[model samples]
Target chain A: MTRTSTLSPVPPADAAAEPTRVAVSTVIFTLRRLPGSETASVALPLVRRTRDPHEGLWALPGGWLDATEGLDAAASRTLAETTGLAPSYLEQLYAFGAVDRSPSRVVSIVYWALIRPDEIADASDENVQWFDAASLPGLAFDHNQIVDYALWRLRNKVGYSRIAHGLLADEFTLAELREVYEAILGRRLDPANFRRQVENSGTLIPTDRFRTGSHRPARLYRYNQDVELADRGPLDRRQ
Target chain B: MTRTSTLSPVPPADAAAEPTRVAVSTVIFTLRRLPGSETASVALPLVRRTRDPHEGLWALPGGWLDATEGLDAAASRTLAETTGLAPSYLEQLYAFGAVDRSPSRVVSIVYWALIRPDEIADASDENVQWFDAASLPGLAFDHNQIVDYALWRLRNKVGYSRIAHGLLADEFTLAELREVYEAILGRRLDPANFRRQVENSGTLIPTDRFRTGSHRPARLYRYNQDVELADRGPLDRRQ
Candidate 1:
């Protein structure tokens, strides 16, 4: 159902006016391998805030929520404005509404979006860079909190859900997929067991493509388009 | 690590004087079965707003976040103010910050809290009453969205996690516990299978005390305090 509201631009004279609230921000993340390493790692997009409210500080790329748009739409718009990136997968994260969270009385509803590393690379721009999740610099506002929560959710969700696939290319080998899980989880998984579990889950459909130039040719697979993993039972059981 | 914000509050005259944000609220829930029922049902504690901005509207009791308190504390305080109740289980839910969600400029960070029905019964006052989830009326602000998300999470989460036990008393029978699950999920579960799954989860510890009642004495169980389910595996896998 769509929710719409028509609000007057001005408040009644007798009523005390509250501060205007409108800002949309995002914490976009992707899994990337560190230099000289085959093991994957979590990375977040960072932009140096050019204006006040923690100007010059490293923060997630975001800006004001538009007055005439949905919060989700505003998030994508803000990310595009700040980093020139459009995320393929976006979902609402927690809202930060502490009265003093912003220098002004600004409350930010932060959305977390996942972009495949390849997607980010294709749309790469000069100002934006992905930093290792562990070595992030001090962030502006309550952004660090947002990042923490997103990381926590990502790590936890990857176990039972096929969300980790969102971080990989469309067609990937079993070894590459396992690396994605291992990276976010910060632990090494038994490669054979991990592949077995993933295949048994029925979320992945086998593709004819195979990866070459490795020690051996590895089979490639794509996510099942018709299979909405979240709706499936037994397979969708909480991790 | 404690993250301390060092950005000084911008003066009102500064160009960075952003509009103050709005408050988002949520009513977290769990089912409480009254004595006469064979099945349990969902319930939420609500308060009548005594002031404007939807004054006198029956809403999920909440208010704007204070300047000094964190979002979590603000949510806890708001819940306490309305129902005189404090939930043992509380977490950040999605934030609702539609520009027109509030009559005033207030962005809310809605939170979902879970509590045993009996624990909150004592706090029920003139303004507070536990209403069946299905029978809720039009709520103030965007509370309907908050409740919907919470219920969705509850139903989805109870499958693998022992979170349902948080809604029960210190010790409860398998039937009563199963009722909690069935009520939230809105499905009738086979008693034999439910028992088997719960037993296999190993999160519940059997108690020596049997629940003495009209028919047969049912076995009592309690949440196993010793084990940390969240730490057992990845967040999703732990469940």
Candidate 2:
């Protein structure tokens, strides 16, 4: 390998003045199953930055990572700071560092989180709102790239894992769960096949509680307490 | 949320004199099948850092990102600088920012790349050597975390995609391919079922050439040039 002086010397004085800093940001998503729509749509929470750098522009809710905090703690903290909502589950998504990504020397470790839409009845702050994946405003920095990658992972992993359930309450009806999948997938699925697949996966357990509404009573189900799918295997390919 | 200023800002005069700055490093990996191994083991090319902080430590070949370089570019540049390797497929893995991770403020954005091992070998430099995943040394920083995630992803993703082929020669035998899978999965698979699954997935195309060995001529197989599996769905199921 050719050794360059560039790699040998310590970083310059200006570099030291603004030493590279660590931050944690997140793309929190929930599937909104819109009735009468062709398919459910994916929505992500965004906060308009109240400070500079990309002040006034929309971006994922995140901020500086605390030195004593772990990655997961930082993510939850940032989310709560901007959205006033606590995500139940979070996973490391990707890290964003392009030299000029920020005017300041900042590199952010991005995480993806899933939340149920009903849990967020309304925007707690004016700066925060859910934007449909298809119609998003200009995002600050390389956040657009982070959102794209998170969407790609979600779409690709849903087949093997029952990720759709995360976008819903602990107990939900079959139709409600199906709608969550359809929203993220952006296509209508055969109701029968979708139910069969979920059932076969053995990740969901039926409950006696039923959803009572306009037409008829629908059976309710909750995630299987005994089986923790994330710890099981690579893709959770049970069904 | 309550805001607190925990750390005092660095004095401007002292900041100018500090030569070294903190930055993150990355060690992207992909599976590579070698001639000697019983099966294809996870192989990553490592380069010895010649500078302080980790002067002689054998580390994943990476370095400081320019203030203008994105995290992705820094990773790509590190791979090119140390190993003369460029991967067509690369994705951000994770960030390691434990305060003690680096003597300097370097918090690395590790990436994972999937490519045919042949490509890496052909691009090999004097400083680079491929090490089996199961048998690796104590790496420079939190690289062990990055490697662990990559291995976990390989073990998880190979079931759905033709990821093993990314580690093999363009033309390979079924036995060679199976070894790659077994090495990553860490288990013995029924060869008959494995073959059946690969064929049924429709990701492999049979080539006209055959490899003549001690027993018989093994038919050569190549990755299907066309079928790209669409992203599966959301990743937030159990959460």
Candidate 3:
């Protein structure tokens, strides 16, 4: 494309700046059982950048968006290519386009995804490593801020939506479910309060199956299939 | 820039497709009083396109994003340029990048803004016009879908956050505040129930001033300065 075609809307004075490029990145979160800890914690995989603009620093798994693909498709592609894992739940988080975010003029359309522990496949490699979302090191670009925002969104969504089901199995005891919430919230919740709240929410369906634990025999529950995991409005159809 | 620089991350075959351009657009919603109506309706300004690709059709006020500007800055700049109105609240809504959304490969970082009825400025011109957001005609590109999502978000957010205050003035009666909610919700709310809910939320501060109406004088109230209009997570710092 000539300078006049794509750059027509931009004035000649502003045209001297490089054209803005688009990139797709994903903050994939999952429940990981940390060593010496019974409760799970939120964790995400990061790719160590080999090139400048913060070489050797960990960054979100992403790549430049291919013009032929849609934004959602690009997010999924880049995530799978970089992390070698496919997430169960993915949603667009935000578009970060701070001029100083990267060396080049680029806009990153960041997506946050949720992976069920059962589906996490071969995530850690030589260049890729999983880090606790809360205790992440200095990441490349503005990724630390991005991860914080994603974690906030995850915790916020868990309160009103049925998103916590993405972290658990098809059927689990209430205690297990409570653990997921406690992990994401980073605090212990009153078991009685958690049970009453989940029951009132009406998103859970109690199953006849039971899990016999050391404390007591607990009933297993599954998410109501009729209800969506999260309400993403009209754009959820693509997902 | 060489073909290997910005487009390097994309494969040679994928790079054959045109490099995507970033554009910033805003759905600036404001409450406008209609003729022969007591309550206001949600309305937004649209610019009539004068070039090909849905020429003569109405579209959201926007322009191609300049690389030198950040996403938020571009949104504010393009919004002010296309529509001569500055809004009270503006937040990033979503990033729309469906391959078929436009004739050219364009990814629009859409923002939804709220304008208080008092701060609305001269908005009508030969090319730009305000249309009822609920009953908009066929718009250019994928703007109709974008507007629907924004309206959905506005309604959903009002249920949880104090964002409805953005559409209100500094001080208002319970009846006036209810009208703003009723207008955006497109339905009447129980007056007593609405009062009890907002009061219980602890976000309002009753003032000495009152609105003397035909029925009874109702006390006015202002938003609690300590509470933010909306909880935008860490990104709230930017706004």
Which candidate number maximizes lDDT?
3
Cα lDDT of candidate 1 equals 0.66
After the best TM-score superposition of candidate 2, give how far the Cα of residue A128 lies from its true spot, in angstroms.
2.6
Candidate 1 scores a C-alpha RMSD against the true structure in Å of: 7.0
Give the runs in model 3 whose Cα sits over 4 Å from its true position.
Answer: A1-17, B1-17, B159-164
Q: How would you encode candidate 3's per-residue C-alpha lDDT over A26-96 as one tens digit per residue?
A: 99888889779878898898888876778778899888888778888888888877777777557889999
Residue A171 of model 2 has an lDDT of: 84
> Better model by lDDT, 2 or 3?
3
The model with the greatest DockQ is 3
lDDT of each: 0.66, 0.67, 0.78
DockQ of each: 0.20, 0.28, 0.38
Q: Per-residue CA lDDT of candidate 1, range B1-239, in tens?
A: 11112123432332224344444355768677778987888888777765566655677766655555666776776677666777765566656656566664445666776777667656425666778887788877767666766777767755433564467777888888877778887889999999999899878888899988697988888888765523423112100
Model 2 agreement with the true structure over B62-132: per-residue lDDT tens digits: 77766666666766777777777787655555566555566644456666676675575564354566677
Which 10 successive residues of model 1 chain B have the least lDDT summed?
Answer: B230-239
Error of 1 at A178 (Å): 1.1
In model 2, the Cα lDDT at residue A190 comes to 98
Q: Give each candidate's fraction of reference contacts reproduced.
A: 0.18, 0.21, 0.36
